[model samples]
Target chain A: MSSIHEITLMLNGDPVEAAVAAHTLLVDFLRDSHALRGVKRSCDMQVCGACTVLVDGRPVSSCTMLAVDADGASVVTIEGLGGPDGLDPVQEAFLEHGALQCGFCTPGFILATKALLATNPSPSREEIVHHLSGNICRCTGYQKIIEAVESLAR
Target chain B: MLPRPFTYHRPTSLDEAVTLMARHVDDVSPYAGGTELLLAMKMHFADYEHLVDLKRISELRAVKRNGGTLSIGALATHAAIAADAAIQGSLPALAGLCGSIANARVRAAGTIGGNLCFAEPRADPPVLLAALDAQLCLISARGERHVAASQFITGALETVRAPDEILLRIDIPLTARSTRYERVVHGHRTVAGAAAVIAQDAHAAPRVWLGCVATHPVALPNAEAHVAANPGVLDNALTQAIASDIARLDIADDEDASADYRRHLATTVAIRAITATVEQEERA
Candidate 1:
């Protein structure tokens, strides 16, 4: 019985393997081991959505979750979204709407919006607000972000 | 902040999880979702040398209805419970409440068992579960026993669950009762909350419970007695009954809300819950 757990999972689109300590957080593992700096770490508590990432297609606060928890799951971060040629549609929508200011909270907002749209292709304005309420954005005053996400709604 | 190093064990079965808990005693915690436990661990508020990961146990994730009971697996996440078809069809009020808890990320990762077991004073589920007369099933190396939801939480961040016990599931008996849960929330924390469960028959006893205003959820026996006697009446007498019951609760003034304000909100939410329950009954 060892505290060091060998975990293998799909990171973004690639299959990756790592032997992480039992106490290692998923956010630390993502940003430190894989260098996915896009996954911001503001407010280690789950209250702030800065550390949100998708595990098995559902958004979870990576900061509160253990790296080993993502072992058999497919995890998607902001770095996993766009293609080499162009940005993802969500990114394009955010860019078009000018949904960012300092852009520190942009990655988290974009990823949360992607998750929202993936499950519900057509979401009401209220639904979008309710879904993204966990992800805080102090820069854009949230109006532009809502409008940006609204533009992508079906 | 990082939690101290610990041994993580992912047990595939209930017996194995029980054995692990029994082996480690106070040094272990059954990790489910980890939305609350991990945060506490990182903050150095709690420490455990061993964590028995309960995610792999398939039996603990089942949400099903058998005969007259709705058995909700303890490990069922808030998001999963909100989206569960059976919950939506049978207990839509509970489903709606689950959807509104915390935010998208917390809902996705927070488990009902973890929420109830954590026994956070501001949590939402315990009140509703108690009002609905839910039975909590706990298993250990010794055997299985059921505790009424109302008696589960002893104090804030405390429960009667032993070190070797694991919460298996929540059993809610399906009855002809219309339930409504109402709350006032400041940010993610519930300020004051109430649950009203009114039976279809006017003669049957109605259940009302208030939470987030005290150390633990408590039954408003006086108010419930009034409701049970009057049946759908929300007059001055009912209001007085509610006020008397609220006066008995040991509420504290906190940064989230003042003691006076919480009492006001508690009374308001309780009236709203009962009114909504009555309205629901009328519609049905």
Candidate 2:
């Protein structure tokens, strides 16, 4: 039988609580329950990084993670990155470099970049490529994305 | 797609986790990073009525060096293993391999225990761990037992671990003076992988294992014998030895690669791995 878990976690710096079913995936929880549609669901198999999210400062495949697993952890969705004032630096970099043609993959790429920059503030070109390898983007051929992230590298 | 509904048990201790597993035996699975298990469940390939989440068991995440052995807790994530100072100091090659497994997200979420337990034919850790002569400690309500990494995996997605048992940790002795792991990746998955190790005592026979080219990691006895016979050689004879050994394995054509192509790739990696170890030995 399915069980309901009452989970309390920090979402995008805000404390939130919910009752999630055992089988509810984190991607569905964010998009459906919280209406955070910025986290897209393309490849539910974890191969595609379209459903990427930061759990405790590390990038994880939200499509494969259960919502209940996020209890007591801090999760950051794409919606959590920017504010009403302005876009996140990673998003701004993408905009300036024309890194996106279709924006379906932008959020995942940006968040993955954010996670990379968190641990390695100045990742080399190879490091950036390696870190974002999981996040696939069919549009723009990834040149602009690499350039955008490279510009941010110190 | 969402997995079929099941009861989730979050056990804070290893004993609690095993107790839950024993109680639910045939219907339960001990959940780790869920990188493989959840994906399989979503695809409707495998389903369990109960899942005992082992994340909260802190003891299962430790990575420490105890004298001559490196003890890696079962729940240690690939990222954790890669960044660990103990593993880096004792077996930097393993740390490097862990860093490159799958991708960044997978590295952050997938654990070595989960990888071994799932026993995916294309997985990376098994071949390298087997070559290192690592030991796995499994615990159950009845008792605990130790098994060699080389014999832990029986086949693809198959292991000797009983349903009521939980893999506690992996203990690797720091006896190898030089080690190298080489693989050919078609995409994110490895098409073929080879690991070679030369023990600190020069007289000991070299260990060589091939993975991702078969159902489980297979010891390349002929390749090991070649390395043993020719201590510091990377010649055509060595290549022939690896090729001949690979030819004997029963490989099948799959969508990723053909049998002949896999054999070729396996030989290339095996030779490269042995050559790398030899080069490292010379440098030392």
Candidate 3:
């Protein structure tokens, strides 16, 4: 029988308690269990960064991570990045730079940018491209995404 | 897609984790980061009845330097290694290689030990680690043993690690060297990875290692001999020697590239790595 794990995580700023199957993915736990539609599931494989989320402030592919792995750790999805008063600075930068086309890859890009800016606020264009290599966008071709991240870097 | 259902075991200590793995034996897998193993499980390529998660064991999450050797915990994330002060100060080439892995998320989620244990030929760590002459510490209920990096990986997706053993850490000799890693990738996966390490001492012989194009990391002895024989020189004869050197290896065939193309790439990549390392050494 599959074991049922009772896990507690700091989701965003709040504590969330869940009883999940040991194999439940962090992406599924957030989308199906918590209704956070912002975490998209594009490539179930670990390649695509659409399922990216920050566990304890480290960006990881939620599709590749077990929900139980984050037990007792802090997880921040795109929805959690928004402030009570307004959108996150990364979201604002994306908007100002028109960084979205289909909008499917925006959350992942935003979260990745948030992680990048958090650690390196003034990354060069090459550094930005290197850091964002995990994310893929068919519509934008990443020009505006680069601009968005570059603007934030400035 | 969700991975196949399995009982999860989160052991807070390495001893307990080893005991659990030993009890389950062939039916169990030591889960760390879950990037590669989970992918195989989800794709139905491999499966396990029990997964022993080792994240809670904090002892294996450190980077320490004692004497002439530097020890990096098995659980150290690629991103952690890339940003680690010790690694950056001692082996910037390795730090750069770690930074240039699959992507940001993978770097954040993947562990050095997990990478070596998985023994993915296309992965980046093993080749450079092998060139650096790193050693992996394997521990279990039967005590512990340290295996040289070159011997740790036996083949593609295979290692010398026993079912009951858990890789504890990776230790690298702490000596300054002119090192460079070169790789070509398509989409999200690597096509080829090659590395060159020249000891800081001008007369110290250099070593070359290549990956992804082979079932295991291939060290080129003829190429190293060529470089050592002709210091501060790169020419057609050197290229010919490198080509002949890697031609002896048994390269692998994947959908991305054929064995022939990989062999060709091996020559170019090895030359590129050696040339870059030599230039950097001269500049330094």
Candidate 4:
């Protein structure tokens, strides 16, 4: 095998560079290298959406993407969604509707909703369910989350 | 956990990527959206010394229409396909499948080519592509070639793509046939164990592709022929034939489901999908 390489890309609205092992996952790079621990890693497999982030404005499971594959691409983590002063609409809706319980899966779900609503501001109930089906939440049942998103549509 | 150490190269062009793959042979693997490839690497199921990242290749990200057919770039993410109104209009089934794939987050990053090339029996797009007779464009250091979806998958986690080849695009022929998809999942608790059926009724023999019941997506020729020969007798003969055939397939083992259960689900889902397709055609 060859040695690890250094790569640079726009991350969370900032141009960042990091030297990582060729096999390093984007999730690890965000959490460890760049210290953007806002993107949590749950299952680490593509099955769970806890590691969801936007790659060029599209929500993608960061755990399934290689750090090198993200080179030259624009990425947005949960931190980029909002800051200490305020929150994105989806985040606010999540909080207002009590869509989270453990909050482990909140970031992934919020990002997924953000991506969905960006293109579809008025998604039907079925559309909301289908869109968020990939992000599994073990707590607080998806009813409240769906309610929150539905409320947002209103 | 992170994947084993390896060298990564981002090729700016398809030609460069193919050349890198040709030079490295089996030691090199292509990384598209890396949804499946990266996960496989993390699980230690693939041990390649070098990864040729195709993200930098601009040509592979296009979603264009050539004449009546829709040519979706291999690198086009599921989100892109779902959001494209052209795909939604020309291939509604394809768009619906893209929208329903895994989740919004995964779909945002996962590519259609990656899904098909992964050769997972349960993957969504392959079944729909096979039923629609989608053409896969392959490129390599040598040249380009086109293969039908049914001919692309050789077996479980396997494909006809050579070591030096990259799947360039998926060309879906524009047709007036109405299509429908039915997926039977045990309620989304686990990742595996889902049966999907895609069918088109306008052709002489309505095409049906069954997923999650075999090593690769299976085209139900017997059921299709049964429907074509006796369109009136579809309910009984088609269902029986598909059920028996699915019962006999050798599906890969997974934690989410057993071989027998997947077979049963496949037959059940195929019946529903076939009926739904017929009803949809009637409504149209």
Candidate 5:
């Protein structure tokens, strides 16, 4: 007997309300219901950061988070990071660094990077490595990803 | 993989949370960040008929030091705990331990109470918290009681907390002369972890508590007595003896590593942690 919940959250700077199941995961809720596919569900488990999204400005694994838990919170997906002007600095950096090989893990890494930079604008290389350890990328060897963030730090 | 359907109840206060849990005692799980709970449910390792969401409870978001003890609210996220100035000032090792849990996303989502309640053998907080003589406040519709961190974790993935009870807060005495949590690695849950808290007084020898080398974190009365007896201890043999003694408990093995390897790693970590604080204690 699953129950439906009316969750009103600020999605990507806009107040979006939806009716979701009690067991609806945030990733699926965003992707399936809201048609926000930027949150890649690579690792359903929290270990892989493919489903990373900013909840209340803090990066949270949407796959592990319940949709109801995010009610009334502000959530930022990869799609939300983009402005009318152009790509976000993180996306541009990834593109400039050729950080993505398959691009599957790009959204997670980009979101994590965005959160990291927002909090610690001048994170050291060690800091960047330490903070982003949760997101796993299978391609590009992560050297370019680190460099991408490093470039932002500089 | 999405978890099986479970009714969700978001309670804004501790009383409401506990009562909701008590109403569905056998089937309700108090949800925090849902980092571990959802993962377990998705893996088909757990199923709950109801989940009492505790995240909205503001009382459980405390991270402060009051009356000589660092009182950490159960709902405080790992990232908050790690970044807390009070925790850093009093128990940097605990802060460091919290900071290194899983990853950035988990640190942002997971809470200290949830981590300790899970009681995974490969856990980090219990190891350090137990060593630091932390106390946990448990609340239920029945009543409330404080349990020592050392006694909270009875076994792997098992805790003394009743299904109807919710862990409200964690209180750790900020008393160690110098504390150090030495891990085998970072960016991963520790296969083996050693946390050492040293308190040296003119009235008595240094008191030491050891954790993560056994099924549960334990007081090294045997090893402490040995170290106290030999105040200027500089022998490798004694360290080996202490290590073996600490590893006397049953250390189980899973895919992470073999029992022997786990014990061996535990011994190494314990010895290193002990030696580190002991040296600091002696210097001070």
Candidate 6:
């Protein structure tokens, strides 16, 4: 096996470095090495958006990204989407709209919504559906999730 | 599933990146966002011994517009393209296509060059680029070359991109013609496939490109020629030939969809796309 490589990046407002295998996924590095388990690993593929995170203020599936590729980039996990003390409006909207059942896909959904609403403050309903089309949630059937994003748009 | 172990090299300069790729050749995989490549690697679909990370190469991340053409750096993400005012003003079809790609997360990380270079049959950009007649610029230690979008892709998951070459920029020429895109995505199921139709009424004939059809993006030349030749007979003949050609096309069908259904969807989407393009042109 190839030797591990050291990568440095800004993680949720903190500068962190880790020696990860060249092929180590960003989600695994976050969950295991950095201990920021808020970014869940579900399908471990790009199909399911459970592992989404913000790379330079844009949401991306971390499972589909290598840790070393994130060098000098800024990443924001679900934990970075504000906390119990002060929640982001998107997260609050998700809560208000009951967007989660088991909550396995909540983090990805919240972060994806954050990225969307950031660029488009008041997107139409069709725009919401189009923007969130890539994310799959078996538990919620996507109605509440759409509602959550819609509520935020309003 | 994790990707196979490989050495990582993050080059800050495009020249250095090109040199690294030229040196490594087939062993090095140049990754932009890794949205598709990393997933394919995890699925064991691809194996490379080295990865030349292009995210650190700042030169490849710019989007500039000159007189008559827009030069978009290969590393510019889909989100960047979709939000770019120049793209929105000049090529609204491209902007709409960018916004309509997978989703926000995928758009954020996915680069236009990466998506085009990956050459996935279901990707949205190839069909739009083909209709737009976009030019793909490739660079390597040897030299640089430009290939039209239609010639860039040879087959499914295949491109003319040499192993030693790096995609530099995509040049889109400005034309007076209007363009539009329409796609029918099966939204009920998890793996429901999509059929996208791109049409541009530029010169005499309206060029149409169909996605999710054949191994690569398929151009409807016969239909386009018919429309161009007989500008007055715009209704049944054009639709019939195009639909028939689409039905006879040989495309891969997995368990999620059937060849017949894809053909039907392709014809329907193509017709809709053409109708939309014509309607927009008439209004303009």
B1-284: candidate 4 lDDT, tens digit per residue: 77788888878877788889898887888788777887888889987888888877888989999996889999998978987999998877778778777767667778899888888766877877887788999988789999998789888799999887889999987764667677765544222222223334335457777875667777777777776676535566677888766666667657777777767777777777777766666676
Sort order, DockQ high to low: 2, 5, 3, 1, 4, 6
Candidate 2 docking band: high
Order of candidate numbers by lDDT, starting with the best: 2, 1, 3, 5, 6, 4
Instruction: List where candidate 6 sits over 4 angstroms from the true fold.
Output: A83-86, A150-154, B187-205
Per-prediction share of native contacts kept: 0.89, 0.91, 0.87, 0.87, 0.91, 0.84
Cα lDDT, all candidates: 0.91, 0.93, 0.88, 0.78, 0.82, 0.80
- The better candidate by TM-score, 5 or 6, is 5
Q: Report the lDDT tens digits of candidate 5 across residue range A1-154.
A: 7789998989989998888899888999999988999898886888889999998888999988888878889999998986999998889999999988988888899999988988899999999999988889877469999999999995
TM-score of 5: 0.95
Question: Which candidate do you rate higher for lDDT, 2 or 4?
Answer: 2
How far out, in Å, is residue B178 in model 1? 1.1
Which of the two, 3 or 5, has more lDDT?
Answer: 3
TM-score of each: 0.98, 0.98, 0.96, 0.90, 0.95, 0.91
Task: Please tell me the TM-score of chain B in candidate 1 relative to the true structure's chain B.
Answer: 0.97
Count backbone clashes in candidate 5: 0
Candidate 5 clashing pairs, residues 3+ apart or interchain: none
Tens digits of per-residue lDDT for model 4, A1-154:
4557778889878898878677778888899888888798888887778888887777788888777767778988888887777988888988999899999888888888888787789999998988888888988479999999998885
State which candidate has the highest TM-score.
Answer: 2
Q: Name the candidate that leads on DockQ.
A: 2
DockQ of each: 0.73, 0.88, 0.83, 0.69, 0.85, 0.66
RMSD of each: 1.3, 1.0, 1.6, 2.9, 1.9, 2.9
Give the Å error, residue A59, model 3.
Answer: 1.1
For residue A130, model 2's alpha carbon misses the true position, in angstroms, by 0.8
- The C-alpha stretches of model 2 lying farther than 4 A from their native spots are none
Q: Report model 6's chain A TM-score.
A: 0.92
Compared with the true structure, what per-residue lDDT tens digits does model 1 show for residues A30-87?
9999999989999889887888888998898899999999998999999998898899
Give lDDT tens digits, candidate 2, residues B76-180. Answer: 999999988878888999999999999889999999999999999999999999999999999999989999999999998999999988999999999999999
In candidate 5, which residue ranges exceed 4 Å CA deviation? B200-215, B231-234
* Overall local distance difference test of candidate 6: 0.80
